[model samples]
Target chain A: MAHEHDPPLDPVFKSSLRELKWIIVIWLVHFVWVLGYCSTYGYLTPETPLITVIGMPSWVFWGVFVPWIAATLVSSWFALTQIEDHALPDASPLPEKSEADEKGGADHE
Target chain B: MNEGSTAALLTFAGYTISVFALAILSNRVGKGKDFVGEYFLGSRSFGVWAFALTFAATNASGGSFTGFPALIYTHGWTLALWIAAYMVMPLVSMALIGKRMNQIARKTNALTIPEVLRARFESPAVGLVATSLLIFFMFFYLLAQFKAGGIILSTLFADEPLFQSAVSFVSQTTVNIPWVNQAEPDYLVCLIIFAAAVIIYVVYGGFRAVVWTDVMQGIVMFVGVILMLGMALWQVGGLDNATRKLEQMIPPEHGSAILSTGTVVATDQTFAKGTWLFDTGKVFRLGELAIIREGQSSTVPVKILKITTPFEVEGLNAKRISGQIPDPGLTVRVTDPKPYKYGAGQTGNYVRNPGPDSGNDVGFLAIGTAISFFIFWPFAATGQPSNMVRLLSFKDTRTLRYSIVTVAIYYSIIYFALIIIFCCARVLMPGMEIAPDQTMPAFAAQLTRDAGIPWLAGLLVAAPFAAVMSSVDSFLLVVSSAVVRDIYQQHVDRQAPEKMIKILSYSVTVIVGVLAVLCVLNPPQYLQDLIVFATGGLAACFLIPMVLSLYWPRMTANATIAAMLGGTGMHLGLTCWGYIADKEFRAYSFLGVNPFIWDLIGSLVIALIVIAVGPKPNRDLVLKFFHDTTSDGS
Candidate 1:
């Protein structure tokens, strides 16, 4: 199904995309945990005995502070251990020459 | 000036001189490299510390120092949830786009975001549109930071005799100049000084200067927050004590009032700005200078003074006075007092969600708005072109990976510690609600003075100043590069010589900075609001299009343009609607959510629609950017 002009995908591009997928997943988890927990317990009724944990509102301690620490740990782990390092391609010729080459060659096909 | 003021000024001088030294050294180091590449991109060589700190410092603008602290002092503990998203912001902002953007830029030899987009699509139109939007949004962003710089400097030198003399001289000299004369003399002088310093350093040294300065600024911000945290906790006994006190604290009622003399006074009496006056067992601080002119019954524009607690009154050292006293003959008759819509006379508002707001009935951070900010901090940060520029300059993926972890821990400490320190600020410095933006600097000065080490305030105040300067310099370079490289070299002169490029770059950077200074003569109040609007607008315009172009090979030029223009239009349209409906500058949250949420949604929808209907992109272009053409069509 591949076109004649299309070359194989770059290995670095494939590797980077794979890492991006994991990063997005980690971000989504963090997003849900922060928004879900905070929105659920943030709005408290005046009659509810204002609970305190370590001198902070109990909800904040559990919702934001705890999740924040956890997210930091997860993110650090992912960045340090999970992400792959790859060799970047050398800088190409000036953009004008490349543009002219493309226009003269396969771009018009 | 007192010893504290003198020491603070001297320390500030030393910091400024050191920055110039760095800029000069950076310029000399870049002498042999490609002029444009080295000046704008630092020859694409950034180590972990340089990249991480520059990225972090640029993101931590005036809003972090002035606007954010103001919100914390006013709204209390609710700010925790508001800013909690920063915990993952480093990973989200950097890791998501860093490697891909770097690869793309290197592949295209692109020096700017617009340049990268242009090269990706092979269309000059895309570059032009991107350039236009970048300049437009960045100008507003520059105005906000310039205003913050002026405010910080003004606050730092509030008691200095030299600064007072300069303010007075400028006021007298510019009394007849229509535009310049309208601003407060102190603020105007400070704005000019701040603008000049930033412009000179950036124009001379360029990108390397910005990165080097950012490294130092980042360290100052981190150390400053830690010191303040320790001192604040010690001053307030502990976080628990501060929280308990905050629970019982009442929000002040602020509004303009008419101060009348009970009798026509025999002598002309003048009350300086920030003077504390007491009447009817209540305490108030004059927001501006009040002069009872000879033989006049009242002063016409006696700016606002809020009704604060007697506990604060004792600390304020307020004189025993009444509204209708014959001896001094000063009558404090309040008019048009505007009380808070929520928690006006209540306790326990500070430590709770939907905290008390001076005007908003929905309170400061409604649940919907809270959800919006959690998304805003990371995703919006990712959208910033300034951050994108830093992404392009890091040495390699290892540097990227390590810096991500470093910034994650750095922001965690800075943002969380700021909340704790400013919450304690309410206990130590009352009546700050009158001028909330000055809370950080004022608190720094007061905290150190109380500790009998007033000179330390300079280093603490420098944290915010450094933040503003780092952002301003980066933004100046961005706007300059847009004009020089994106617009000029791409369109006007592809073969332009290097010497001409250097002259234009410097000239454009200085011109833009000066214009920004002039624009902020009467700066917007609540600097955080302006910061949010500009930053949100930029994210709305650029985030989706840039992401798609980097990853999705099928994306066409038309689709990218649609996303940028449509996103910006939605954001501006909503902001205008909000202003017309509310008679204020804030964005109209159509469904109790921040306008940023809707803007992103709308941008994505528009981009998807365009991509669906538009012609397919060039397959050859995809081959170039997304595949290994170097390996020959295998």
Candidate 2:
């Protein structure tokens, strides 16, 4: 790949944004799965229609976990996507400057 | 010889030795600095697995297991609403707060919460207030941990006279001093365990060591919860059986019909009509009612003869004297009633007391489940001072992230398992005649007795000790850091050497240990209550200032300082007086108008007002602090 050194494109922001997106995607998939399971199973049981797996009943799984997964995914995506990678410069390693090499007069105090 | 005590002793000894050995091994292989980071934050060098485990350890304390479950058992499932509220907190934190905090800490070389606040606000006042709140609140919180540890010890070992006698024998043999009487040798042993744990990680490795240990402890905790829960559930014949048992044990009136119908109530009391009134004798009064009972006077009618009336009354009759005296009988009634009918509502309907069958035990599990979301999310993105320090001690963030994630998954599983197990305990041991807080430990003992699984019971009993030790060590490190880094090093004498920092940290740790011992010696009546009050106060003082300073450019030092002081004052004053008055106020009603809610509201309000009214901060400095991307580049 050609090393395209885009002046303002901050790599850190890009990576963080990418990470956030993936997390949201995973969270969404989980949420949808839960919602489908709860809704489908919930429709089946006539008396206690809520399908309870383990100790957590189906309704609780729907109400609590589904919403939580959805919120995590959506909110994280929104927050992460807002930070524009083009607005900031890449945070690659910079050449080290010793104390003695400063342009201004050294004022240790 | 109580089997519970014997099992508990063996379990405790095993865990202590294992933890100690782990600490020693980590120390031996790692450099002092590396060990410090690992101990505090699990070497922040952790892979996803370690990171998850550390997070679990930090979050899961005695509060989660004992206090939370006890609260649920006492209050009913309505308390689960709080857990739902908390689910959003971590996601909010990660998406909104974590990234910025992590970036800032990495850039500024801030190793503690106080340091981060100090750096962001550019005001010593903010730092001082935040540190003070942290110390004060954490002290109470730590005390709760200690007390929980003591209870666990007593529960697990109280009946083992042989173990008690052995401990007593050791104490007497080691230091044969005359006229020395220790109350409950088991309590002292708990104290020593906590003290030793705190000293090792804090005195030697600092934040880094604490984190590493936290990571390990967190994993163990997660696994422990899952294993125990699974075993309990399987023993009770799975979810169907468990639910059936719970239904049978719980009165028909107390069943959750609404929840059963796959609907969540907007309010907690929707199912109130289906539950029995725990307090049955109370008369139901709608809106208001005044009771006026006409009866014969307790005092016989007295004849009064005055000097002026003596001439008239003496000859004919006596004048009856009746004076209004204070009514001796107490009439209990609700003054201000809502739409809900009193006593007719479900057992969990009452805000103050949820009846025994209120399905409140489920609340703890709900909270545990919520906590899992934050366990290893974002791969340790926030880098909390303690957590960050651990990360820095690690070789790289990739390792930290991996360890954290691994631990997170494990923790989630364990947490879910614990919930299942605890609920089963509730079903199996309905109205179990033990202290509500000791329900879990007691149940574990019962299981051991019934099933003859000494090892599992022993392990379950020792879990609380592990929790206490992990939490206490972390608290000590944070407290010591505040003293060493913020106070002694920063304020008292600038340019303090590393040696001096080490010395100060150790000294602070020792002092805190002594204080903890003294505080526990004569614990107050409402220790847990006091802890909640303190946590609310601290959260109020710091959360807003920290959040705003991280995200907002206009947050000036003046505004931050004002918010810190104003918020602290408002929260502390309201909380203190409110507790004294024993009446809830509108201003105080945030999250049931608890002190924490009040503090959070007060701080946020003050911060906003200050930000709006005060002059904008130095824009150049703000940008340099917040947007300096190159500052973190190695």
Give the best candidate by lDDT.
1
Distance from true position, residue B405, model 1, in Å?
Answer: 0.7
Task: Count backbone overlaps in model 1.
Answer: 0
* Regions of model 1 farther than 4 Å from truth: A1-6, A97-109, B176-178, B260-263, B297-331, B524-530
lDDT of 2 at B221: 66
lDDT digits (tens) for residues B81-128 of candidate 1: 999889889998998878988998998899999988888888777888
How high is the CA lDDT of each candidate model? 0.85, 0.50
What lDDT tens digits, residue by residue, belong to model 1 across residues A1-109? 2476678887767777788788788877877887787678777754566778987888788888888888889888988988888898777656554554334222222
- How far out, in Å, is residue B506 in model 2? 1.6
Docking class of 2: incorrect
Interface RMSD of 1: 3.1
In the order shown, the chain A TM-scores of the predictions are: 0.75, 0.39
Q: Once superposed on the true structure, which residue ranges of model 2 sit more than 4 Å away at CA?
A: A1-58, A65-109, B1-4, B29-44, B72-82, B85-90, B166-185, B250-411, B580-598, B628-634
- Candidate 1 DockQ category? medium
